[model samples]
Target: MLIDALQCGNFDREVFEELKAGGFTCVTPTLGFWEGTLESLDELGRWRDREREYPDLIKIVRKAEDIRAAEREGKVGVLLGYQNTNLLEDRIAYVELFADLGVRVLQLTYNNQNELGGSCYEEHDSGLARFGREVVREMNRTGIVIDCSHVGDKTTLDVIEYSQKPVAITHANADSLFPHKRNKTDPVLKALSQTGGVIGCAAYRNITPADACATVDAWCEMVARTVEIAGIDHVGLGTDYSHKTGPNHLDWMRKGRWTRGVQYGAGSAAVPGKVAKPDWLVNIGALNSVEGGLRRVGFDEGDIAKIMGGNWLRLYEDVFG
Candidate 1:
């Protein structure tokens, strides 16, 4: 039941081939982070064309049951999601509009702060604003899974406490294991787990850094530690496997019309480009390696099933109701 919570890579033939080969049930890819309404609509249109082109290989997941159904059909389920509410343009009604359009997941903020709330990169965590609270309610009402991957710590906590349904940190690691601004702190993990929310443990190079020295074993150990903090049922895969991203994708991701200047987020001026994925996660089949590593770290098949995708399905069933 392999389900990756997030993958912002280019959705090309090779990537979809890898997914089919890897036996992936579903993958939630970012449709928009900072794109405005029109651009977001274009993103959806591009995906619609791509899905039609590969009719046998890809199926857009409009519901949670569609994920399992895609696996049965031997196809990869595509869950359209966004990393920011900027496209909403302060319109509360747009939540239902996008949900009706089959956008199942919506992150509150991106790298920088906006109308919804603050981001992890912001110096001051203003917590959830009044509009942010309203947005949460609308998302809950419309059956969109609220994501807090790039959201500020304060805002995330506020959201977890305030939201009627569970909220997810779609793709990020635990700060206790690999302390980074992008990683979730112990408090955030506790809050998420207690509320039956899941944190998709990222296997991105910068966050996991599963290099020659660190190795896949170390990465799995990190996952084990995260499970200890976030609980086994509250952890899942969010590999952030960026395959075939263009040279300017990072520019648009970090600085999406909000700034004329360059914002080299997570990267420096010296290496202002997309960060490399861990060598072990080069393809979808590498998920087997992750399962093996987790076994070595003492996770049984049932618990691992929860981590891989079962818990996410449960959350979807609860929220996508």
Candidate 2:
């Protein structure tokens, strides 16, 4: 019952088949990032059609039971998620509206500041704003998971303190390991673990070490360190896999019309155009390597199970009511 907590790849039949073949029980697909309310809804509608188009391969998951049902039937459950709350804008009610639309996971901010809070790339973080706090309250009430992956340090801490329910730093790594802006600090990780929240370790090359060091072993070592800091129940796989995507998508992800000039995020400046993914964790199919890596690093079966997908399921059961 492997569950990938995050993957925003090119959504198609081939991708679905690959996930199905990889033994994925469920996955959270990012439906919103730079999109507004209407655009996000359009994306959601497309996903609805996809569910209809590939009924045998994919099913919509609004709760833990939906995930279990998909697993039982040998299909992958798709949990609708957002990488940014730009769609919510100033309207806090949109949280509930989108929650009703099956938006189970939402990241407060992307790489830049918005109505919610400052991004990780922002020079000065204002922490959680008044409107952001209100949105958090509504999300807590509506059962939408709070995500702070691309949020700034101060904002991440603020979210941990402000959220009534446990929050998630869904697809990120430990900054103490690689020291990237997208990675969370030790204090933030500790606080999240203390609150029973989970941090899904990402496989994006930018957040990890350079080149040869970005092997499955290195990632497992990072995970082991995370468990030492954040505890086993607070760690899992988010992967952040974005395979089969074109270069234009990368440009849009970084700039997103917010800047007239291109904003080279993380390792993009050196690579110029392409977004690099680690070879060992390239896509959902490579998830087995993660399990193997965990085993090599001496994580007992019980603890490895939690880090693989069980931890996220526990979180969903507690929060996705």
Candidate 3:
């Protein structure tokens, strides 16, 4: 089965190896979120060196061609993305720099207001700021896909209307099914679909409806609801797998210097509590790995193929190419 996974936090060699072993042809692994300029540069440098050292297990992917090539070679194509624009550090030039370094998808904000705009958890969403408009334009010019999963309602709408290219909300749920701040409302879904953007349904336990049991079938049902609202063409899977992040990581995310400093407002309150064990959190393992989950949901091969990675593939090609 095809899987477009997003791995957050520090990269683990063994975990990535397992993804390849388990049949993940392409994955969008995040490298920056709440990272400062210097830190991001250092991380990029390290990633560059690692890619050079381990060319077989992972290779940087920029275009749709790279993904196709990876599939042919039986290797996992690593598409670099960012969960937040912190690395931009109020500088628009960084967008191009990141694009050049193989970062393709960029989420505008995390959980609170930044220079770009308000986050999904923010109490008052004032939409995209002046600087955010410039950032969006620059991203379009650089061929980087914009993501709005964690952005506030107003900001998300503003971005959908403003972007010259189709933008994605890399990971989110339907708020109509589960009334959480992290989930997108019906109007937001319609607007996103209207723009030809894709909404990747996430699989976090907290984000799904509390009434819905925490299982692969339940998650698929939630995704079905999203498809009903946004249409199948605009929906895909983006399992925000924090498979290796423990309680310490959650605490870091909640109280980290990056989040505390920039993400202020009621939006920050929506962030989930830290998981005690990294394994306890959602990962491909939750569905007994990617292929298992698809089968459990009774998804036919074609439906599974589209939701697994085909939709994301089409969306990426349209925006990046």
TM-scores for candidates 1 onward, in order? 0.96, 0.97, 0.88
* Tens digits of per-residue lDDT for model 1, 181-290: 88899999999999989999887766664442146677788888889898988998887777677768877787877889878776667767776667676666787677
| Candidate that scores best on TM-score | 2
lDDT of 2 by residue, 138-193 (tens): 99999999999999999989999999899998899888887988899999999999
Provide the lowest-lDDT 10-residue window in model 3. Answer: 274-283
In model 2, the clashing pairs are none
Query: By TM-score, highest first, what's the ranking?
Result: 2, 1, 3
Each prediction's Cα lDDT score?
Answer: 0.86, 0.87, 0.76
| Full-model lDDT, candidate 3 | 0.76
Q: Which residue segments of model 2 deviate by more than 4 Å? A: 211-214
What lDDT score goes with residue 96 in model 3? 92
In angstroms, the error of model 3 at 53 is 3.2
Candidate 2 residue 294 C-alpha distance from true site, Å? 0.9
Q: Best lDDT goes to which candidate?
A: 2
Indicate the residue-level lDDT of 60 in model 3.
76
